[model samples]
Target: MNISNYIDYALLKPSATEHEIIELCHNAKENNFYSVCVNSSYVAVTKQLLVETDVKVCSVIGFPFGAMATKAKVYEAKLALENGADEIDMVINIGFLKSRNYVSVLRDISDVKSAIGDTPLKVTLEISELNKNEIIRACEICLDANANFIKTSTGFSKGGATLTAVKIIKKTIKNNAKIKASGGIRDYETAIKYIDAGADRIGTSSLIKSSTHAHQIRNTKIYRKYIETIQKTTDSAKPNNTIKEKEV
Candidate 1:
């Protein structure tokens, strides 16, 4: 399976320097990974690096912690898009979700979605901070808010993506809201398991390949009901070839 299509080629480290960001974009360009998920500051450079390529630039909004004010998240998302971000991965307020104030969480996601317009929004649930019931409830709220994807973990928490958490998210989401299994994934082997377990995308940093557009995905086909905006998961629908690493 050419898993490169499923990978986001993540590099969300706080200590990442501008040089490293440039290198990250270079590496992403050299490989057919679906996108480069980076902090908002690097969106512009990454976008410039990835020009004329299918590899998209995904920016994190609200970031590892979702405690920022709703307006702040909206502004961040807007600015990221202005700087050339193709996707917005925003964190949900864990405290608000724990407080059973579901309305606030819903509005938080919806507000960002509105600000970004057609740029698909991924709601990071921080599955590590929530229990099964809470995860389900958070997924419901994201569904109500019309989020494009439900991501697991920020890799900043105690735990990262787990097959069990992916199962919970898969069971909870309505419509075609895709699932991005992020955090902890660093190899092709582990990433494969997440997809088999139902993840529509994989976020990682330690994986790479020689650049080739053989499996790159395009940004089209909105999967929403009333709103025809934002693209679907990076070619999640493409059939995985039986060709193995040895063959490649």
Candidate 2:
């Protein structure tokens, strides 16, 4: 599979400058990445840069941490959509989840999803902080709340996506939801492995690299491997021809 198909090609750095955001959006447009994920502060700039292109602008709400007040998260979502963001990646409240406050968790996600209307909502589960049971419950909660995707981590967590976590998430969600594996996916191989484990999208900071010859290469061999693995894992996970084939 082509590597680009599996990548979201992220640029969510807090210190990104206006020039960098502009260049990044242009690269995404030219390269056809699935989307360019940025902080909410850059949403307007990113939207402006991606004006007429098919490349989508994604902004994070409640961002690296999911401890913001419910109203804050809702307002953030509304503002992002108003600014032309095509998708919003919001972090789940791990604190509430661990406390068994399922109601709050569900309501938080639901409120934001509702606020966005038709825009896609990806809820970051931060899988590293939770156990298998918690991960399953989180996926279920996201599904119940009508979240569009169950993202693995915030990249600011203690650890990022794991093969085991991705597998469990896919099995628990059972294709009812898409999976996004973020953080620690630095090379082409790791990216492919996550996809193989059932990640529909990959979030990483590395996209372009200058090779020894000084030519820029959009290296995503790692991501390609992850996709191949995802194909295999997904095939085995499904019982029959009942499973829908994912687009490459």
Candidate 3:
């Protein structure tokens, strides 16, 4: 199959430089990837780099962690759109979901979706941090929030997407929302498995090293970050039940 069409070529590392982002856009263009996913700061540059191509620019909101305030996420998502992001991938408020504060979790996602208008919003569940029931609950919540896609992970977590998790998400969301299987997907074989399981998009940077375009970025050694050094503190915070209006 045409794996590139399903790929969201990503580079969300906080340390990613402009040069790296430029290379990412070019690589994506060369491979004709569905989109180039980057941090909000790089959306403008990525948009510019891929302006002459059909590749879309995707920006991450609240990034690898979903602990930010709803207003802040809204602002970031808007700015990313202004800067030319075609889609938004937002991390869900894991703490709120874990604390069983479903209201806050629902509001957090819906608020962002509301702000983005028609832009496709992908809600990241960070499945590795959740149980099967939590995964189902998160997918249901995302559907309630009008999320366009239910993303599996942030890749900075302890683990990435698993086929089991994808199947669960597929079963949970059904035809309501699409699925994006991200994290830990390192090769064509692994990526295809997620697609077969029901993922409409594959968010990964690993293919950069294994694809035919490897020669394009081999010397820069830029693919190292794609493997992702799991963030130890990503899920360490205790579930806080307080639903403050301000940034958490």
**Which residue pairs clash in candidate 3?**
none
Candidate closer to the true structure by lDDT (higher is better), 1 or 3: 3
TM-score of 1: 0.83
Q: Which ten residues in a row have the lowest lDDT in candidate 1?
A: 213-222
In model 1, the runs with Cα more than 4 Å from the true position are 208-248
Tens-place lDDT digits, model 3, residues 92-184? 999999999999999999999999999999999999899999999999999999999999999999999999999999998899999999999
Evaluation by lDDT, superior candidate among 2 and 3: 3
User: The CA-based lDDT of model 1 is what?
Assistant: 0.86
> Which regions of candidate 3 fall more than 4 Å away from where they truly are?
208-248
lDDT of 3 at 71: 98
Residues 1-248, candidate 1: write the lDDT tens digits.
Answer: 77778878888889999888888888877777789999999999899989999999999999889999999999999999999999999999999999999989999999999999888899999988999999999999998898999999898999999999998889777446999998898766677789888899998778643223222311222224214322334356668877777764
lDDT of each: 0.86, 0.86, 0.90
**Model 3 TM-score on a 0 to 1 scale:** 0.84
lDDT winner: 3
Candidate 2 lDDT over 67-138, as tens digits, reads 999899999888988888899999999999999999999999999999988888999999889999999999
Residue 49 local lDDT, model 1:
89
